[model samples]
Target chain A: MAGSHSLLDLTAHALAEEIEAGEVSAREAAEVANTRIGEVEDEINAFVTTTPGLALERAEAVDARNGGRNLWEGVPLVVKDVLSTRGVRTTCGSRILENFEPLYDASALRNFGDDLIVVGKANCDEFAMGSSTENSAYGPTRNPWDLGRVPGGSSGGSAAAVAAGEGWWALGTDTGGSVRQPAALCGIVGLKPTYGRVSRHGLIAFASSLDVVGPMTRDVRDGALLLQAIAGHDPRDSTSANVEVPDYLTNLEDGVEGLRIGVVPELMGEGIEPGVREVAERVASGLEGAGAEVGEASLPHSGYGLPAYYIIAPAEVSSNLARFDGVRYGLRVSADGVHEMYRKTREEGFGAEAKRRIMLGAYALSSGYYDAYYAQAQKVRTRIIEDFQAAFARYDVLLSPTAPTVAFEIGEKVDDPLAMYANDICAVPANLAGIPAISVPGGLSEGLPVGVQLMSDHFTEPTLLRAARATEQVADFRYQMKP
Target chain B: MISEEQVRHVANLARLGLTDDEIEKIGGQLDAILDSIEKIRELDLADVPPTANPLDLSNVLRPDGPRPELSQEEALFQAPERVEDLFAVPRID
Candidate 1:
């Protein structure tokens, strides 16, 4: 207990060893995390629900396991509220599901290895609708670095919690840059594996086709470890890839010596902040210095990503979200007729951002407009995929700034939906293309973290991790340095 | 640009009843966003096939068999309105 603060700095892999070796009890780790959360929860509302008591109880369960083969047996994990945890209040950051406690854990979270220290359910944008956590039914999660600034979201709380040492790592879903953007903004490692890389069985659907549950950790190595724990096939999720699960740890430290690394010129173009561009370009130089061939990579249709996503993603959203009616779980407002009840429930339950998206989706998929909007976006999606497939044929991995800019002020782009959507300009292409992409901490720009995003072809996580690990070494940004 | 009536009609179609104030405010924002989304039409997509699934997967069939499913009790645990063993709903008028 005397030197417990330093224990918080250990990665999940290292922390598990400590717990296994009897160096630190699981209970002590939970207590330490709770203490940290208590100290800093005021400035950063990272978690919508904190399970201090449950964490202690779960940690004791892990302690009883007495060091099995699990790598994260006793690690504290911040779960984004969108991923259903059995019996825990899983809000998806929407008031509609404010009191909704799931009866089961997400397939990705099913293998808890006895049990994990459930730090809390991290806050996010309502139904994962917005780019910032400001749209959370619960108030916004402020950036720990500067309380006035935003932690790029809808995974803002998860990123903030990990950065603030509230949780060792977190689970964030990336529909269109939710996980990676927040991770980059919070100066952590975020990985969005290929579309079907991770199971989406229990992840509350925002955009079924695009939603991918990903790992958000303090460093590249930990990100690899976290992804290993959750990445696998689930029969329940029809789209879940039945591919061979590789040992992410094996080729991780293997340098990107002879790998072809491409810096996407389009992502680093005009609208992107100059400071962010400098940092991203420096990452390419750093990787080049580390023995990798670095050059410009062009994804010709990349600029169409935002428009395509707004159409495609929202179309999926309207259909997937139709299940949240008052008839079942979550909020229900009583009315004379069943139709009136459904309408009123959604109107009252959803936040403004959610409503806007549902409207956009409904409008796009409407009778006559579906062909022009939805169908056109789908064709654009094919074009985007073709663009990436061509680039990947020549390059082993592609790099870009994770976000166009560093963490901006909280209220900066809230009113401007277009400006908010622009934050993911660089990230949307990866989702659209169905490829694996990562946001690794690439030092700081304007005194805040800038992320060097590495993307690779489908199911090539090993190669992706190799490039990320190499970048991690070159960046040499202190992961333990907290806000 | 979308008219307010269209916005209302879409909202109704989506099963969401919005107030006049919300409809007016959200309508203005939706117009701007749609304008940006309209830019997707600039590309010539006549010959290109649309990608409904990113992986281009279709009709993944499993052999006919009994599959594991949530028990009735488990499924209805979170139901807002339940009577006896069934999910309760008001009669449609």
Candidate 2:
């Protein structure tokens, strides 16, 4: 494990305090964190690449420039592999780009570099596809809580690193619950900022419209702090929204009293595990105890989110991933002819799930089927967005269980495609509608963590953070898990 | 009839090379997938304008301004193999 006094040992907020006080140098903390990863990372497979030497150098520079102007300095963190990091091997958890190194730092990573040390790139689901890190071409990232189970995925390794105290906090991409679901499973806090609230310039495209980069941390305050640093407009990313960036940490003390919190009736009522339902009830009671007006809210279109996402995501996948053609980038295979070369390259480069998505997507957006599948899915996407907007009109944020269940055994759903897709049933709507959502640890179920998700309309992260802080203060669960 | 030839065309478009046996396997899978997609053809929308932005951000335009450029070394570093200021890859021609 990482040293007890490493940067990973102190919370981002606490580490800043120590750094400002000159109690520890940034380089010393980076070295301690590096030593810890050397001990436990092999067993957990949480990192794809570790750059301790570069991390220490960066730490030294941050220490030298310690004008104490930046709110956070001397904090170490991990960058999700999905975001491009200059000079680092950013594989996106696929063999196709296993050797690919980014030429430029993603704007978000650049911002992170200003105050935090990038310890390494965390492992993830291959192309961010599967619910479990089992989909990674390198290997599955074992849950820190239970080595036998999954850490929930795409951003599984990011969540695992924070859960295991590998880093103070980490950046993770949430496309269809990649960040929130894993954070839920690992008993941490993860936020999926409003679709365009955080720039996507550096992150690899999964479902471009749905993908968001956000913070994964041990506490809600750390999550809010990290969000403040990375949430803003970037000219490089066309999808990035021009919105006011709020001081998330400052406004977090605002209590949820008199705030309208909606409990999604469908999520609480059925198909949810008894344990999850119990936690949801507890969360509502907790909100009510905090002086928030809690009531049931219905979103009927939520039922169709998964089906629509499956169709829409792949259709976009078919087009977005087309750029991976061997000629421009990624693995290229030699064949009898040019056409055969292209054919062989993709077939061999992509994993089974990737292939499945590409084919499904191509068929959905094909000439004859476009109107029926892609077109209809778009309309459904519109309705889902409308449903959330109508609900936000009635409530400050919508509350539900992030996932239907807690972390399941690794390899349990690897072979079942439909069951794997169903995992994102509740989380997909927030993505489709371009809104902010966060998953905070609610309680434990069968020795695993259950998550309570808070979702709000676009650019409502301030309100969401306010609600999250209140929950953190009053939730019956403890932050530290029993070993 | 969507033949193996048509399958090869699409596969080539997607940059996947399939062996003879794999081609046959994927061809069958594509046929089934395509048959299912044929259901979309039944929808008749005479007047619905094709939509892109569901959230209605119609005037989403960025101010045309200069941005920093990636150094040549950084840009070239992303290539799997580069030589003499050019990305090195097997010649398609």
Candidate 3:
């Protein structure tokens, strides 16, 4: 059994406060997280790699400097395997880059240099391709709530680690609910920032257009603190927005008083479990009771979000993953010719899900089929964005269940590709529309966590987080209530 | 429905080598995924201008100047088969 440490109960922000005030040293904070990883990692299998020595070294540096300007300074952070960490291995849960170590830190990690200690690399779906970590070459991470259930992925490892108290918080990437769905399943707060809000220079790309680096934390406040630390423009990422990042902490406590909250009926309809809908409805009424106007808002084109994402994301993945040719770093297979070498190495290196997406993408972008598949999907994406624009004109924020259901058992949806893809629908529309969305713990259904998702217009993270805090406040659950 | 031959071609385009049995299984999966994605074809979206990138920004060019560059050793640090200063691969005829 993992002996409970005193720092285990503190949120990332709280731990930072302690370190900032000299109440506790940064090394102590890092050690507590490293120790917790030892106790629970054998069971949950959340991380692909753990870096206690690096974490302790960074923590000592923080202690020497008395922490930094960021609120998450000196706090232990578990980076999802998709994000590049210099020196430490960053295997995007794929065998292709199994032995790859980045030469330079990703821009986001550099943004937090010396502020956050590196705890470990959280496991994820190979190339951030699947909804469950089972697609990872390493292995799947189990839900802390139930040993048999999935910690929703491809950011499942990050979500599970934070929820299970293995780390103060972790970084996750959301191309299509990879962050929010797992955070929903794991019952921690997850935020998918408006596209380009956070720099993606360090984030391994699953889909260039839809990918947004996000934070998975124990509470919405912690998420806001972490977002404030990492949210900024970078010239390195061409798609990064050149916009001012508002202080996410300022209006976070400004309750949803007189706010216009819209309950998305489309999201509430079929496929969403009655248990998940009940919590979302209760959250709506709770907002209504608190003087926020709750009404039905329709996102008519959201139904197309799933298929469009499947098409569009894979199209991007095909292009992005092409860089992993056999001649480069990581795994390679010897063959007679260069082309054969490429084919054989990829065949050996990439897992099934990765190949599936790659093939799908290649077919979509292939000659004679581009207009039918890739172009058509892009048009659908535009319509989805228009639908959001129309809805947001009336409602301050849209409310829905983050996922259709709670954490599903492992191996339940593995064989079924569409079933795994369907898990992304509720969260996919936000990514398509390039809006900021967050998943806050609503309540438990069948003793498992359910998430209430709130979304706002692009760059409305402050408003989105304000509504999130209101939802968290009304919910009859407590943060940091781990299994 | 996608044919097995088409799947092979697509796999070839993706540079992924798959066995015949694996091709049969994966082809079915692709067919099912395509069936679902066919819903996009149902919509009358011919008039909607395609959004290749979400943001409307174009040509975000960085100032042309020499900044820090990784040395040869650092750049080739993780090569699968490193041979001296260059990355080695099978000789191509």
Candidate 4:
């Protein structure tokens, strides 16, 4: 345990290699991660619950196993609370399921196959509804770089944990911009694979059509490794793609020469912060200098992505969340009758944003308004997809700022829902289009990190990861959290 | 702008009991958000087909076969209230 503290500095890949080579024991790596979590948990509030006993038990098993053939053998990971882990309390950052323990593990977690040690469950927005972790019923997760700022959400805790070195890597689900936006703010790498590319068997639904299980890691290579472990088909999930899983690390070093990178002009203009825009410009020039052909590509419907997302996401949310009624599991408030029990249970269980969204979604899907709101949003979503397809016809990949601005003060946008929702504008297009996209540390602006986003056609993660790795090298922006 | 009455109606439809203050607050907030999203109404999308699933997957049928299922004990493990082998809920009318 003496030299274990330094293990926090190594990426998940490096840590796994060290453990496999007998340079470090799996328990030692877990101890290092748990120690780091203990040091930073009070400040960042990254995890809702830590399973040190389970982690140690798994680590010992890893040490006892034959050979380290699994890529994630002995690696420490943190799973976002949104994913189900059998017997572990998965809160989804809500009081409704405060003590609810799942009976089955998510397919993604099971895919790791007893090798990766899960240190804890990362906190997130209530049912993954909000742009800031402030919507989390437990509390907000603070940015590792500046405790006063938020680690963007609804995957805020996962991003903050990886940024603070609490875990080597963390699993996060992105619906809208949950993973990439937070990773951008926390100065790490987050990749949302193409929809259906990753199984969603145990990921609690937000917007079912848009939700994707993604990885948040300290570096691009680590992100690729984690994605490789979790990406594939699952019989339990009907929507899971049957596509063959590729070796993500194989083509990762293939540089971006002759790759046509498109910069969406609409995302670069008005409402984007000047400093963040400058970082994006620098990333474009960096890619150009590295021999990638970077030029402006327009997505005319990009401006409508955020609006369409709000309508579409909330509509699905209302339907998905109806399962939380007091009849089955989770929190139940007693009343004189079943109807009153259902009403009172939800009233006491859900947080403010959750109630707001449920109401909005109900209204959108109501008899007369459905055509005006829900249908219209779906049509706009189609337009957004078509826009991306048109752009991709001319370019191999698309580029943009991950968010409109850097991390903001924790309480700054909490009161204003519109302001909080604006944080996801630059990242939602990819989710809407069902394409793979990544957020890599572009640079720092006003002392906070800015993310340069790279998006590619569906199922082209090899190209996307390769281009992102190239950008990662060129930017060379190291993640450093002040003690 | 959405009225407090409309907000209460929607909350009722969603089966959520809301306080007066919550109804008023959410009403104003929803109005502003809806106004911002109203820009989507400007486009002439008459001929465009709505896309519910971007992947365009169809007939995703799994073979009908017996597979492992959660035992009764495991299924009832997390239930807030359970009666023998079934989940217990408050009585209706």
Candidate 5:
């Protein structure tokens, strides 16, 4: 038990290397992760379900067969409940599908091969809506940093689990700021890859166009290693990019010497907390100190990002969520008529936030309102994309504070949807333009962690990771959580 | 501002049976949200084409051939109610 406890201090990359060298067996790594989960699950509420038997079965298989031939061999990891894991109850923190289990694995999970052990499913916001995991039908996931405060969502469970060392790393789906904002609050590394960089075949959709699979980890290097294992094209998901996947670790150590970095003045404006702004400034200065050219840049349409995202994402949500009626799988309510069955089932199954988004989406897509709301939002989305294109012409990467404030109390923003939506102001633009963005733990403020967001052009995760690595070394904020 | 009637209509269109209290509450919330998002109208984007997708790929048709498919039992595994090989639901008439 003492030996297993020490393994928690190592990064996923170091743990993999140890397992490969036979100093640690696959079963030992799984046991350590299970121990960590047992220690922290109640305080953190990071997982909806834990799969120790499945993890141990897979670990024993790896030990008997290849024995750490692959990069991720014996690495215990958690998957956000939004991803389908065959035979494991995958709930997107919604009562609608509380008992739902998929028959197949997500394409991204399929890419992990035989070596990566699936430790558990992380909790998230119901149907991946809302900025805090308070929307979860299961109780909210508490921030490991402060029990009273929330771990940001809809990927809160994944971030908290990683922060508390429940697993070496975990996967989260980011639509808007779900992944980055949560990672920022928990003081870990989260990357939202370019829209099609990873396949979304078995991910239950929140917003189809904006959703992307990303990795959350303790450090930037582990994030890169996990991305290497999961990213690439899949015929199963037509939206998956067919471009060449680069070896992310190859150029990860390459310092940010001559790279051009842009600091958006707009992001540091009114709503940003002073502490968060100070961290962004420190990251900018750190980059400049590393010999990179830094200057102020502007993306004018970014101010519209939150408003546009709220419309477009809900518009898609209304369409994607229509599949959960009583006719198919998931929860069903019995009524005399079929139509009444759908209505009653949905009324009973969905939570308040899920109903709100669905209704908002329906109103936006209704006949007379389509051109004014949905189509207009799409036009604004185009302008936001073009604005990024213009900025990328002058700079290689842009930096901003991941969220306006640190993690708030669990019930703080739950009642005000607009206030909750504001959390994604700095995050939604990357999703809008289909670019790669990552959140690295910036220095803490008032004893709470702040995240510095780094974004780059499409398919440029290598450069983004490189810049993040350099900034990470300079800031060097130690991440810790008391259970 | 969106009236409770409009919210009720939207709930009907979306096939959700929201209570009167929920309708009154959601109506006020939607009004505030829409009022803020209404700022999108100020932009003069007459000529810009809407981008439904960032990637411009078209015609993503898969090969038409025999392939592995989920078995009937596996497909019906998660059904809330099932009879034989079919998902059971309420009577239409």
Candidate 6:
């Protein structure tokens, strides 16, 4: 139980000391972390695959090569199921990929090998489709703070694991609000780096343009450290940006003074729970108290984000997920002919949400509707980008409630698709516009955590983290939920 | 209007097998989702090119040589049925 804090909470510098002095072997760290997972994972349903044996073996190897290390040596971590880890099952919480063992590692997972131990694959919404973890075929990951409450999805499992102290940190993919929203719900920190900052190679495509791999940890420091580790360009991902990985841990000591922080007026307005608004306001006051210039910024275009995202995301989901047909790869169901095989495979493989998105996407991309639906949605995307650009030009960072409400009961929004979709109101704009955003615990709403988002323009993670760190100092809930 | 026939057509395109019940069920859900998408039809988008990525980067460099692919064994490891290193399927002939 000694190392049982959010993987991000372990103070990597201290862990590195023990590992360096032979006080702790990487194998020992891996065992400790795996034991922690064993203790609490069942209550949280946070893992799709816990590769304990491989994790221990890899940890031993890291200790053996102790001299060659990065900041995160001997740190235990989890990769979300959506990322392909070579020779390990990467189910993406879909029956289609249920038994599929990836032949290659995602670019981030491959780079994560040095010094760090990959504990296992975290659970997720089927193909990263929904806003709540309830959609996962594997079963919803319960929010560690309150087991009956939902953990935000599709990165819920990763967020829940980190919140439950199962690992030092975990990698999560945010297509809409997958990473940040769950982190908020679970009272942890998650960062959605500037679009293209992290390579998407081997991350099972889910709305490719919106999908970004990021780190979820106990606090901003670990979030930033993990971001620094996993972020960079990969040739395999055509959209990956060629950007320098900033030393995020070194940069966090800088306080957010005289920095311009904008509070979007619409976010704090009606529909945002009163408790959530209070926390968001406290975060703002906390930032202002830290000598940062806080101002009210209006983004009228935000009201349209849900509709625009639904169209654009599903349109991409329709095309990107087209690869899962029962053909050369994935689940194959066969009958008399090839067509029936495709039908049977998809029918059994895809869950309801996946089917809905595929159909919606196909409809938008179809000939009769292409001009009116997909074409118009692209233009709206352009407009949303312009709106964010304008906001960033006037403000250093944009702040909003990560979700309008806290974790609802499981199966609450599952039947109501629109209510499930609306939960990403605060987080989706960044993905649509391709910006960097971080969610830090604001406060609690009826004992459930709330996240205040700090968003900045492309490649401005340094500024985003500075603002988030400043907010973190004032909010002071770094260890709000202890396992 | 998209009917059960269109759903069947799309299921084939996506290579997913659907039962009569599933097709009937999904047909309704798809109808609702498409109805929401139909809202986009109201927007006046003139001379707008379809945007794939919000960031305008193109022609990202790839390693200019062939990368080794997975061996036949690794490739077929997850298939429910396989024979002679090829995925075995129900005979079409």
The best candidate by DockQ is 4
lDDT of 6 by residue, A1-483 (tens): 454543334554456567777777778778877888888888999998898998998888887786767657577778899998887888999888887887778898665573347888999999988877787789888988888888889899998888887876889999898999999999988899988999999999999888999999877877787887788988788898887777776768688788899999977897899999999999899889888889988886677677778888988998888777666677777677765666677778889888878877777777777767777887877877888878888999999999999988888889777778879888888898999899999888797788999899899898899888888889947654445
DockQ of 5: 0.80
Q: Would candidate 5 be rated incorrect, acceptable, medium or high by CAPRI criteria?
A: high
Minimum summed lDDT over a 10-residue window in model 2 chain A is located at: A1-10
lDDT of 4 by residue, A376-419 (tens): 98999899998988999999999999999999998998989999
Native contact fraction per model? 0.88, 0.23, 0.85, 0.86, 0.78, 0.56
Which consecutive 10 residues in model 6 chain A have the weakest lDDT in total?
A3-12
- The residue-by-residue lDDT of candidate 3 on A1-483, one tens digit each, is 344657888888988888888898889888888888998899999999999999999888777875345557778889999999888898999999988888767777765774458899999999888888899999899998898999998999999999899998999999999999999999999999999999999787889999998999999999999899788999999999999989899998889888999999999999999999999999899989887989889999999999999999999999999999977698899898888899889999999999899999999999999999999999998999899999989999999999999999899999999999989989999998889999999998998989999999999999999999999989867876455
What is the C-alpha lDDT profile of model 3 across B19-83, one tens digit per residue? Answer: 89889999999999999899899999889998887777798999999998888888887787778
Instruction: Say which prediction, candidate 1 or candidate 6, comes out ahead on DockQ.
Output: 1
Compose the digit string of candidate 1's lDDT tens values, residues B1-93: 789899999998899989999899889998999999888998899999999878877787777799888899988988999999998876686
lDDT of each residue in A320-435, candidate 5, tens digit only: 99998977688898899988999999999999999989988999999899989999999999999999999999999999999999999989989999899999999999998899
TM-scores of chain A across candidates: 0.98, 0.97, 0.98, 0.98, 0.98, 0.96
Off by over 4 Å in 2: A1-9, A113-116, A481-483, B1-13, B18-51, B63-68, B71-93
lDDT for each candidate structure: 0.90, 0.79, 0.90, 0.89, 0.90, 0.82
| CAPRI-style class, candidate 6 | medium
Q: Tell me which of candidates 1 and 6 scores higher on lDDT.
A: 1
Clashes of each: 0, 8, 0, 0, 0, 11
TM-score of chain B of 2: 0.75
DockQ for each numbered candidate: 0.84, 0.31, 0.80, 0.85, 0.80, 0.53
Worst 10 residues of 1 chain A by lDDT: A1-10
Model 3: CA > 4 A from native: A1-5, A114-116
Q: lDDT winner among the candidates? A: 5
Cand. 1 Cα-lDDT: 0.90
Per-residue lDDT value at A317 in model 3: 94
